[model samples]
Target: MPKKHLPDPEKYELGEPYTHLGIPFPRLPATFEKNSVPLKEDYKMRSMDYLDTPEAYSLFEKQADLIIENGWKGIIDVGCRHGPVVDILMDKGYTDFNYMGFDTSAQPIEYAQETWQEFDNIEYRVMSWNEFAPAGASKGHKQLGQNNKKETDEEWWSRAGVKFKVDFHVDVMIWSGVLLYEPTYHLWFFHNMHNAYGAQNAIIQEPLKDQRAECWREDLELNTIEHRLHMYKTKYYEYESWEFDLDIFSGRRIISRVKLWQDGDSKWEDWVDTHGQLAANPHTEILPSGYKVIPYIFRGKLNFELSQRDQTLCQVALEKMFKERHSHRLADNYSRDKLHLGKMYMYNFVFDGDEPVFCSGVQNVTDKVVRVFSRYFAFEKYKTDGTTLLEKNDNFEELQYAMHWIRDRIIFWSRDKSPKFFERLKVKNELFSEWTVHPTKINIIYPNNEQYIFYTPKVPAEWWKNGNYDGFFK
Candidate 1:
């Protein structure tokens, strides 16, 4: 007799594929709206409305055409939860294209497969996006996907699934509105893109200016910035100073400073001209037609893989990553006989100590990895299973110490609070630890989660009270 723990191998346990066979398609709830669809008020059916939304339609059109035109063989919508977007596309008579939708949610995938069984070209996988962090980030986690109950919301997808491994080079990867709902995964999503097709092209539809206005308003409204600028403009005195006013962050001044450049009348014109492209002209008339010069860092391929060395390096890097991270461990219990060798696996990087560490998970494993990493790194958990032990750990002293370190190093980059200061840190090479430091402009062009760009730099005029990077030819 087989051991109780191992379970009888030859006993022929009723597996999911057989038991779940002939399971009827999910019916729209009774409370559903017209056309046999779930009600808009129902939170569970939130993914459906994206089909009717104008923005979603337009994005779909653009991506579909872009992918076809760009010679991309297919497209993958990362975090494609319910495949509603694809359904919409099919309804619109958009076919003859290659596509795959992945979600960590199994019932949804099963429902999708059952609902759209006619589409021979489409495929689905239940895996979290966190599986695609950098090489060293995976920290060998656990597995998931033991149970397979379609009716139960707490099935495999609801549970954390397997870890993912990423391969770059998708022609036109599109994410409709998934990122907004999962804000904390912003970095994780970008990290996956950067790793997968670091050199390939991508088009992400995200809210770029959504927070910029508020961020700017807070920067302009600070009294310290006002007073400091006034002092430098009038007195032309040099001093390093900071002021704090309670009642900001529950009686704490959250924003420390906003560094602005103040120049004398003669040099002011020169400064304005230098940054002309970034500013808007007050007068529409052709009175010099000045525009402010806005500095933006972008990531793109420096050159096509024209050079043999570049191609070789790309292959080598990908091979090393494939050999190290891809085990199809994430796809365990899913019939290895049918598994394809060309299948891409993406894994998340959980830093043991600020290093890119690796971890694996079966169906529900990625979710656990996400939770642990977020808690340990103080990163907000995006789409994962449970809370981390680190969060519940009652070691107040240790937590406080960690927060203090994070405050000085990480929190300082809170652009929401202090854009100017954060920008300063990004451009300037301030030593954080022996391992990590501020990245230069070049590094910003090829950014990863560990990398970020300086949206705004604090250029306190006090620093140039006399003159520095200010006067022309001086």
Candidate 2:
């Protein structure tokens, strides 16, 4: 018999894939009016009625595309002004799918209710995500996905018509252009959505903050971004992200991740890619036109083999990363099935301005080994001719480099030594052959300079057959 200690849903399960009654994305109605919508102060476009235009409709289509691609059912879109995404989804003529959307704007709520009321299992409310704030932050200490059907009205946010009458269950929840507006209740809503409302996955889109200008910095100060980078590092085993722009100044990014616990019992141990380091993320770059041409930290998925396309992007980035950082060793010919080049994962990249100054993620993993790369590209000195200072050096062996892991803790770099740091690590878009063994005892640095040393337990020599080499990380 199977063990009884595993986790599962008592009142909810993963929502079934929505079955469509007709062809996908039939023509939607053009009843959405745009001419005289009230514009908010300091705004350039129509408020809430932006969906009436073809340009803005395309944006909603993109967001809706991400939702459908995730195979989500029973969606709850936070800050869903006018429910443009709902209209896009319903145009597909899918049946048995449920949608629940909420926004603070009363006009948009009324508009959505009047328009989408024709569809069954659809709801809209003039409510904010902050209405369901349970006290305290859930830093993984709270038991999650508990939509306890018996909670009181206050517990369920059922105070009259200003809140949810009962707990809602969904496989996925989403928010676009909502994260930049909430200053305090941002993370709390994300936490409560899973812990109280039973949303297992999330797709979040927000403007990338650029602090070079005071106006941008002040705008960012009005919002909260706490615990985001850390959350991305530790929460999901695999996640997906992409970047897009509506216009030039828009550095919008979308990320979707499944809860780690949903991957089953034993697999939870392997979910977190622990070697990520948060480096300097230059949120903006002043362009020649005096406007920012922000590089999307998201162009494609840099996940750990999320897809073949993702793998190619990350592999190319990795090869270039070794060259950029001047790192040498990455296990010469370590092409074992379990710990091969395909497993080399891309975590996140930090841009200093236009150039990526830091890259962090797992280098590769094995049952006995896990190597995470924390390549700090900023530490290398640059010349006036736009090349790294290390480029001019003739004798590579004579030079020395240090990784400042902490305030005082430092690691030395040498090609002959274990845990090589900077040693001409790449050749022709591939790893060099001079690299031999994976460091048995080596340090993995985080973006914050937190240090962790990963090593395997010592074993007797000559344990495996000749050329079997199954013990070392290599």
Candidate 3:
């Protein structure tokens, strides 16, 4: 048997307390500093004019929409030049949010203050990032001296906090078009603004380095030492953060949305605290031909090196089975190259002694319809030949196992991200409509002054038609 590295919920490692770490400045190409645009009246006008195009302002508006949609109420917009976000908020008739916008350019700050003076919970100030976090502004981070003593990096960060110099706390921060200017400290500034600073949510949009003009790319050099998104590798399955990326400007720029929290409740959700439960909790079933199918869950990307052989075996078996059934329409597509063995999130396979008879997997997060575009394969006796004469070729029972696994994932994700966020998100299944999750629920009240508004979405036993597993839910 291949070595299995299943998740241990009790031992979920939270890679780091703060991922947005401090880094030294890079060697620059003199042009970036010697020839930079001045932050003045003309710059402010160009910024305001840039908003005239939907493409320019849509980024800001989307951030606003997400903030309101997700129930986030505070914003600390870095590089808030001329306050485009404030305008978008006011234009949308939204007055519930508290916004703090700061820019080094006095002209833009003055213009924004004068333009939106009467608004409540809105403030603009002329402040430099240097003033916010002196270490991030310079060529490198130096030991900060505090109380006449050299502060340790951890102590410095603790005392320092994202170094924005603000007294109050805001759960969300947005950085739009802000990285374009930081040339050297772009990622450094980025790491500090998002979850690295303890913000519950972060939205960042910036030009892609590869897409920038050659001259601009050479001048506005970003650090190659680390990537903004790659910083997330250590944080995934530990039940903390979930993220989504967006393409902007027809792929010229990109937007990264990062949320640094998930439900780890032991009562409603115990998966986070105990990953071992996933493997221990198997969905076993007996096929009509009396072949037993068992499902085992694996976490993270499946190490393809060990499973590559089984994967190919399943692929070849599937193609042969399909061809025998005269189903070339789909059989031709079951090539070994399409197994996608390396991308499994919650991986499941029925490996009987290093021989994979069945396999299926799905990613942790789902788009539009909280559903899975599952990758599954199973070995079956398509023809009545040899000792497998009683075997059914379709492997419908294995497919149902895959469906059950998908439902398990959807429930885990809905609870982790909050089921309310997925009200319109459906559970779609192309193969079997009976297994699909319907968008209806019946409320139940708890006794003794208690109310469980929990959305306990279920896959009713009646849907199975017959007790296929001989009381599987039992």
Candidate 4:
């Protein structure tokens, strides 16, 4: 996927939030100052444009949930101009959440603070990161002392705040529309936010300059009204927004040529020949061009959260078992099985420490399809780390017991038809005569005419050491 575009930083309106086409721009928090100083405007524009897409919001929500699951306590919205994201979170009933918003603009802060005053836990800070760093640092504390304690960062930066380096630490940090102003420093800023502050997670949304250039170039393809119609059809998905283009052909001239449906759901609909322009109803407007929205999903991981105790135990048990039974062969033994015709694969077993519950195997059945099989074993199998088939006769008996168990439960099981496979085996041998009887079930038939007959109590612990019957009763 292409990265979002960033606007020219030089053209950004410094000290105040910039608006695009009358849509209020996302605020740039002071903390991004050192990292985004020269390219601030570009960063801001890209971040804002990306967040404007509904898909971005959904992705953020999923990431937030993942972070929360790992014990993150709060969400910090960087460059939060009017608290649009905060408001959305509140409406979703994710209340009692600790929210902190930072911005360089006091105007947006005042509005957001008033609108969200009910969220007593939420805090709004109108301080530029440039000013905050120096004031908070030991060096600035010595030089700017008492005066800095009373004056906010935004107030100072708006007048005469000096630039200084600072680091950020938080649960979830967000940056939108800020990267557009600092295009070149995006990578540096990303690393700074991720590593410096040790933040649990970070989200950024921005635009791509190439996409805009492509749109401009394609506009030349539209010479006539018909050409424009075709262009719209081809590029509709790229449009952040659009209005209905109408033309009236009065005899020889179009008396009126104007766009209609300037606002709301009316302007976002699909055009219909019979009904004229169709109205669009959207649940959320996260993207600039509403029609071509692509949803993104992401999960956040806490950099500090420890792995679960249960998970650690499961991992250790599986690793030990796998190393014992299926570890790589020694260099000298590699040629021992050179004549084995069929391809062979090994499967590792995992258990919950109570009893051997499941066995899974992954193998290439043929070139066309790969098959996987899993079953629960009735008994646990534990062999010495160095044990091999040639060193132990018990291994053979163990294998036979497992085979009998599987044949009774899985190999011959049939839901829609009678187990004709089981019946056929009984007909072919005298030892399996019990299989055709009323009270007996076909468990296992051996190659030499001997049958392993299983009843309730006769099932041994070793019978379940391999992939044998897991669900069938005696």
Q: Evaluated with TM-score, which candidate comes out highest?
A: 2
**lDDT at residue 221 of model 4 (Cα atoms):** 21
- TM-score of every model versus the real structure: 0.28, 0.39, 0.38, 0.28
Supply candidate 1's per-residue lDDT for 318: 31
Write down the RMSD of all candidates, one decimal each.
Answer: 26.5, 21.6, 24.8, 23.7
Q: Which candidate number has the best lDDT?
A: 3
lDDT of each: 0.31, 0.41, 0.44, 0.34
What is candidate 4's CA lDDT for residue 43?
Answer: 34
lDDT of 2 by residue, 309-414 (tens): 4344435545555554433234332222322334433234333343433343334334434343322232233223445533422112111110111111111222
The digit string of per-residue lDDT tens for model 3 on 271-305 reads: 12122221123334455645544333334443233
Q: Model 1 over residues 385-412: C-alpha lDDT tens digits?
A: 3444222222222222222111001111
Candidate 4 deviates by what RMSD? 23.7
| Candidate 2 TM-score, true structure as reference | 0.39
lDDT score of residue 446 within candidate 1: 15
Winner by lDDT between candidate 4 and candidate 3: 3
Candidate 4, residues 227-286: lDDT per residue as tens digits? 123232342222222222111100011111112223222112211111110011111111
Q: What's the best-to-worst order under lDDT?
A: 3, 2, 4, 1
Segments in model 4 whose C-alpha atoms lie over 4 Å from true places = 1-72, 132-169, 186-197, 212-474
